[model samples]
Every structure is written in C-alpha cells, then in structure tokens.
Target: MENSLNTLHTIAFTHRNLPVSEIGNLHIDPNDQKERLTAFQSAMNLEELMFLSTCNRVEFLFVTEDIVDHRFLHEFFNALYPKLSETQRKLFADSAEDYTGIHAVEHLFSVASSVESMVVGEREIITQVRNAFEDCRKMQLTGDTIRLVMRHTIETAKKVYTETNIARRPVSVVSLAYHKLRDLNVPLDSRILIIGAGVTNTNMSRFLRKHGFEQFHVFNRTFEKAEKLANDLNGTAHKLSDLNTFDQGFDVIITCTGAEKHIITKEIYQQLLQGETDRKIVIDIAIPQDLSPEIIAENNVTHISVEVLQEISNANLKERSKEIQHVEQIIKEALYEFDHNHKSRMVELAMRSVPEKVKEIRSNAVENVFHNELASMDSESREVVEKIMGYMEKKYMSMPMLMAKEILLKKR
Candidate 1:
C-alpha cells in the first residue's frame, strides 16, 4: 500500500524572519517562473504539484511515490531565490512536513481557513489559494488527489466565510486601518494618505473610500503607477520625494509598500508633527514593517503595526465564537469527505494489484495440471483435467474478488 499510493511531502518557505529588504529582493520575477517550474520538473517525479508565490510567501506542494531527498528540494529553493544564504535557507526550510492520508486533508483545510496565514481570517489568502490551484491546472500538473484536496479546501473556506463572522468585519490590514482610524476618532472628512500603489494599497484606498473618506493622497516609488491609482480613486498622487509637500494635510497615514527599509522614519514623523493641526494616526501593514517601532513610541502620535493589528484581529475573531464553531463543523465535514476519498483511492490502487496476483496463480495452476496430464493421462483425460483445474481456479478466486467488492461498497 505504501509503495502504491505514494508518500506526501509539503514544503513551504516564507519571509518569516527575513528582513523586509530581503523580501523586496525576493519578489517573484515573472520571467523566472518558467525557469523555476522547469527546475521542479527536473528535480522530482511529481504526481501532483502546485506552486504558490505571493508577496508574503512562496510555497511548493508536491506528492510523489519516489522518496524525495533534501538535496533536490534544496536545489529547487536555491534556484527560486539565489539570494538566500545558509542562515536564511535554514529559517525558511524549517517549516517542511510530511503528511499522509488524513493529516494532509486537515492541513489543507486549515490553510484555506486562514488558520495558517500570518493574519488569520484574512480573506485574501482564500483567493491566493484559488489562484494557486488555477496555476496548477494551467500546468496540467494536478491529479485526482490534488484536485480533491483543493476542492475540499475551497469548499471548506466558503463554509467558514458563510457560517462564521470571522470575515464579517474588516480583518485585512486595509480594513484594520479603517477600523483603527475610526477608533482614533478621526473624522470621515479627514484627509488620508496611502503610500504604495500596489494591490494592497489599492484595496486600502477603495476600503477608505467605501467608508466615506473623500480626501486621499497616494504615493509610490514609481510616480506613474501611483498616478494611475490616484486617477482611478479620484485622489491625488505624489512621488516619494514629494511626500513632504503634503506635510500635515493627511490626518491618517496607511502604508503598505515594498520598500526594503522604513520609509517612514523618525525624521518624517517629526516633520509631520511640526506641521500638525491635530493628532494623527499611522498604520503600518507591510510585513517587515513600513514604520519603525521606535518612531511609533513617540508622544502625541498613535501608531499601529501589523503585529498589533494581528492581535486586534484575533480578538475580533474570538468575539465571533458561535460562527467559529460553525466553521469548525464545516471543516470536520469536509475533512471526513476528503479522507474517505483519499483512502478509497489507495484501496483502488491496492485492488489493482490483486488482478496480477490472481493471474499469476491461475497460470501456475494450469502449468502444474498440464505437466501432470503429460505424465499420466490420455488426450481426453488431459482435456477434462484442464477444464476442472480452470473451473477450480475461478471458483476459488471469486470469493476473494467478492470480498474486495464488499469492502469497497462498505466504504462508499
């Protein structure tokens, strides 16, 4: 059975301890995707494979019968991010796990539920997992197990969202910013500055607008991208160099940039303070952190980092206790179905081996009967003996075949 179904290994590497500077450098280069795929194809006998590359993490999930050596996985990682040193490699590689059957199903469901996300219940992760599944489909790399697992995970996530209030309020960094802004008693008419024109920033801008924030200023390292986002949102755009021009115009600053280091330092916040008409709120959503904690500790300023928001988000999640219970029920149901299917597949593969064994036994029995006939029987008697032996072989095997069928039926 072990030889038939294959062992499963799931490997994930993320920017857990890596500096923000290194994360920006590790951004997925579209041109390199094909090369990375090629390297994976060469390294393992993959029965199923999915590669998920996002701003927060890059993970590879694979299933295979062949025993995968660490060297192959190491090579694949090095190829994807050559900048990683031995220390970085160790940090990233520490999260690998091997799961078979039921454990794998549970793990996948947990991931879809955002239980494994850096920010729990972040809805963006569900979309990310869906996109990763689509990519796997595009590569023609998925099989029955991968497809079933993904389908179950997606369904479980939907159930979690619909059944739980985990997603009821704003839990994403952008939404959390809106919540924090409101909590800080910042008026809806207060001008807000959103730094970075990437997806996260764009989403944050939309969220702010949805909450009736009319005054917005967007800045990016690339002026054109920022301008495009600003135009769409009917806000103003500025380059990083022009950030000082706005001074105290912004009452709330929300930053989600790919900058390697702190874009908002003590000096910049001090300048804002110098021109302040009132207190200001700052939310840093970037992974490595867009705002330094030291700057946040200053007086007359309110700052919220991603880690702080995560705690708030978790507290909010706990408030939805009934919904979480419902989500747990959904996950259990989904896991049961997934595990049944996985075990059924293994049983089917095992049953396939039965036919060859039966045929070998039949051939050996026929050979012995023929040899005995040649030594002691006439042509007519030989024919009769052969017929009898064939009947007995079939009759004897039929019981085992029926038992296998009954086992499958009971599983169903």
Candidate 2:
C-alpha cells in the first residue's frame, strides 16, 4: 500500500506551466466542470481522481497502479477535450508538469495555501480548492487516500492563514475590483451594475456587501442566478438581455463572466452611457474580458481591466514578502507531517492482518507451554500466570513484527 501511495501523481497545467494564452483556452465552464470530471475518470479508469480547474490552472490529481507519463496525458486530453487537434493534445501533454512522491504533497499544500497562485496570498483560491475537493467527492471519484490528503491540505491552508499575515490584505482580482471601485470615489448611492453572476462577480458582490455597499443591479445570462444573488444582497436582478431596456444609468459597472467573447461591446457601452449624470467606472475581470478593449478606451468611462488589478496586487505584494517566507516555512513543516502520516496510513493498510496473525501464533505457543501447567494452579495463581503469559506474548510478537517490517521494507 505504501508503494502505491508513494506513487501518487499530480499533473497540472498551471500559470507556471502554460502561457496565459494556453491557460485561457483551457477554462472549463462551470456548467461543464462535473461532466468533464466524470469523463476524465471514465476515460482513464482513475482509482482516485481530483480535478481542480481555475482561471489560471487545470490540475488533475489521481492515483494509479503504475507510474504515468506524458503519453498517458496525451490520451487523457485527447479523451477529455475531443475538439483539440493532435497537435493541441500533444501540446497539452508536453506542457503539463507532474509531481510525484513527497513533492506531490508539497505542491498540493502550496496550491491550497495560495502559494502557487498567479497573485500570491489570494485567499479565494482556498475556497476554490475546497469546492474542487467537494466536487470530486460528489462525483465519487476520490478514494480514502485522496480524501485524507485533501482534508489535510485544507487544514494546512488554514494553518498558513492563522499563522501568517499573507492573506491579511485583499489581494484577489475580484476584491481588487471592489477596492478600485471604492477608490474611484463612486458615491455610496451610486447605482452599481454588476454584469455576469459567475464566481468572480459573486465574490465581488460578497466583498462589496461586506463593506456595506448595496446599491446593486445584478445581471446574468441566467436570470435565476442573478435573482438569487440580488435577493441575498438586497438588490434587484435583471436578465443580461435587458441591458438595453435599463432606463437608469449606473455610476459603476463590473463585468465578470465565463463567456469567451466580450459581453459588453461598443453598442452595449453606448446603451450604458445613456442617461448617465455622473462619470462612470467599469471593472472587467473576465478572461476574454466582458467589456471590449475599445469600450475601455472610451472617454469618460474609467476602466479597470484584470491586468490593472494584477499590477495593483503586485504593488501590494512587496509588503507581504516576509509573510510569504513564513508561509513557505509552514508549508515545509506541513509537508513533512503529510508525508509521515501518509506513510503511517499506508503501513496500517498494508499490515492490516499483522495483529491478528500475531495473536493466533502467540495463542498457539502459550497453549503448548501453559495449557497443562495452569490447570493445576489456584485461581489467584492462574490470574498471575495469565499476566506473565501476556508479557511473554508481547515479547514474542516483537520478533515477528521485525520480520514483518523486513518484508515490508523489501516490498518498498
């Protein structure tokens, strides 16, 4: 079991492994996430599979009997995304980075702790990891080992937060969007148009709600989701198609969607500009960008693109470098414990019959030695005799235990 556990593999196509262009192409829609996860499992016969897809990464962590290579990934992507050409499939395989043994544990911990994020110390990544873990479990793709490691990784992430100040500041792109809106001095009474109700805008709304900003008009392709977020935040909800009908102009517009194309184009921007009494601000946090770059260049509309937020996040990073160092040290300690615990679990799993095997062997030896001898002793003497026998049983078990360990070591 330890041998198999030690062979656990984590293959990731992350911001570090792939360029932004490739990463953007890999974004799985929230609706299709589960289907893709299931597809991966069925296609690969994965025993223990975990899929984590985010804006900057697409990672697959799984356990298999034999070690995996790039060829496996080539087939994996070929099955996972059939639209990809052979060249694209091979590119996906070639670009993926794998971590095995203890490095897998370390890498997982780093990711959960937000150490591997494009913008370090963004706490939302922990939530993203948690959601991925839950999704895997819901899909029945995880085995005991994966469950244990994922739970431990989440715990380690919490420890990083509690022990360090790395996540003390608002560092995520969504949170930065909220801060950017605040900095632009949009009045509290300003009508806020929240375009697209995906994770980014959801997070942005939550951040703004925390700061007691509530003048919102939530819109999404799915009106029900928009209504849900709006009702929760004490705002109004509208279908995205109703933008042209919105008689009221907004002082701030935040466009964050999972769509690949621009959701707010020049025409939409023109419609948004109608009836505006004050200067407007727009925060576009989507990958392809919900607002067109041409709209961003328009006069009188202040635009905050994801790139601008990233620059702001980078500027704030200097103040948290010390905390980052502290977190790396914490991750090292957590990795040591994870490896040790995993080894212990593997041993227990592998030697599950050892105790019973020893018990049977010891009982046979004791019966031969004391079956007749103890029958003639008094009751009190019998009790004392059994105590002595128990001590001898433990002593004898040690020899077998050592031999068993040798066998296990040889297997390793």
Model 2 agreement with the true structure over 351-385: per-residue lDDT tens digits: 56766776887677668866787677899998887
Our tally of clashes for model 2 stands at: 0
| Predictions in order: lDDT | 0.69, 0.78
Stretches > 4 Å off in candidate 2: 17-21, 85-91, 209-214, 221-224, 240-247, 260-262, 265-280, 292-301, 353-412
Clash count in backbone of candidate 1: 0
